[model samples]
Target: MKFRRWCRNCNCEQEVAPIMGYEDSWRKLFWLLEFLRTEETIAEATFDEYMEHLMFFGKLAFDADDEIEKRLKEEEVSDND
Candidate 1:
């Protein structure tokens, strides 16, 4: 399925295609989430652990723009030297 993502450089939403060649991985993840949703005996600790992991990944995604900008600035400095 096609998705739309905000393009900071263009200041507009752009259509994005799913990354190629990861269908099996995506399917596995989908199945895992489905299982979790349907399972009635999930442990509290397991749910908390998964939440922590999700938050960590979310932080990485949110910080990506700043990381890219920092790297670009570092590259510029090195190029000048």
Candidate 2:
């Protein structure tokens, strides 16, 4: 599925972008998408892989913000324990 957030350069929130598909790719794609938002650079190979996944996954955009938030919180709690 895809996700979106505020984009400073565009001065508006972008349309949801499908970054990845499948359970396995979703986790890493979340972080990579965030990095792109902050104007961070990823390796060429990784970028190619993400784009390939995007095409292969077909059109599926989901607001995974809440899921990401929950996972992060769970990780924090486990870390403290």
Candidate 3:
């Protein structure tokens, strides 16, 4: 059985074990980026902050996505049985 982390905000599936280490940071970063891209607001400081958070969680997010997919598959199998 495999476990994974799921990011509800981005619907990203990560393969790594769940860790709250940078969840908040990533969430804020994602929000900021979305706001900038959608609102066309130029907030340099916010952009910088968003990048910093992305750097911290970029790798984690990838891994977590994989794990999440694996877990979901397992759950489906269990439910079928």
Candidate 4:
């Protein structure tokens, strides 16, 4: 199976053939979190701004899933009609 990488910053997509192993991918994700945690500066505000960004991204992801489901349901209804 082939995997694809999407760059949100560059708006580019490329297919990666013979993707890395599952364990490697998991490790990469862990490393990425660690890097973000250590490298990104968190302001000394009342709340953790970093966490706010994470929550925002999480909400966006959930919203996208909800939208996809809604569109699929609408399509199904239209097809039945």
Candidate 5:
């Protein structure tokens, strides 16, 4: 799957592919989000950099949710068959 994301560093639109295996993907996203939050809370990165990371993480979360939903729907259909 493809997702359009705004790149703050390059100041352009970039295409992203998110990993989609339910548990594995969620774990990956959870770690990424935790790292971002910790960095921001500790002021480890500059303001611009922190915001950029937040945006990227948010986009990933959105894609992850979409992937989970798609997988569930597919399973439902298969079960009904």
Candidate 6:
């Protein structure tokens, strides 16, 4: 599924796909969405600004690790069922 985030320039939410050459980071994008949910500045920051933030500091969240762990747990549960 495509990921969604707020865009200050569009003055509404926007969808984004995995960036070229970084398809593995789609999970990170999901993490970014969850990260943005509680953030206050994205509402004031333009889409480019957001991209810049992603480019520079996106990997700090470690959400992908949590997501992977959760999925593995789900697989284990399904296997047991």
Provide C-alpha RMSD values for all models, in order: 13.4, 12.1, 14.8, 10.7, 10.3, 8.5
Question: For all candidates, what are the clash counts?
Answer: 0, 0, 15, 0, 0, 0
Model 4 clash pairs are none
Give a tens-digit lDDT track for model 3, residues 1-81.
333544548957655423333356466456444444333344434657657656656667667778999999999999999
Highest lDDT: give the candidate number.
Answer: 6
- Model 5 residue 7 CA deviation (Å) reads 30
Deviation in Å, model 6, residue 31 alpha carbon: 3.2
Question: Model 2, 49: alpha-carbon shift in Å?
Answer: 31
User: Model 2 segments beyond 4 Å from truth?
Assistant: 1-62
- Where does candidate 6 have its weakest 10-residue lDDT segment? 17-26
Q: Is candidate 5 or candidate 6 better by TM-score?
A: 5
Tens digit of lDDT per residue, candidate 6, span 1-81? 676666646647777653442555656564565446426756456767767777655555466667888999999999999
The alpha-carbon lDDT assigned to residue 15 of candidate 5 equals 57
Alpha-carbon local distance difference test for all models: 0.54, 0.56, 0.57, 0.54, 0.62, 0.63
Write one digit per residue (lDDT tens) for candidate 2, span 1-81. 556556647757665545344355555556455545445343333667667745443333344555787899999999999
Winner by TM-score: 5
Q: How close is candidate 2 to the true structure, as a TM-score?
A: 0.25
Per-residue lDDT value at 81 in model 1: 100
* Model 1, span 1-81: residue lDDT tens: 654554436646665554442455444343344334334533233767666645654566558758898999999999999
Error of 1 at 75 (Å): 7.6
Model 5 segments more than 4 A misplaced: 1-43
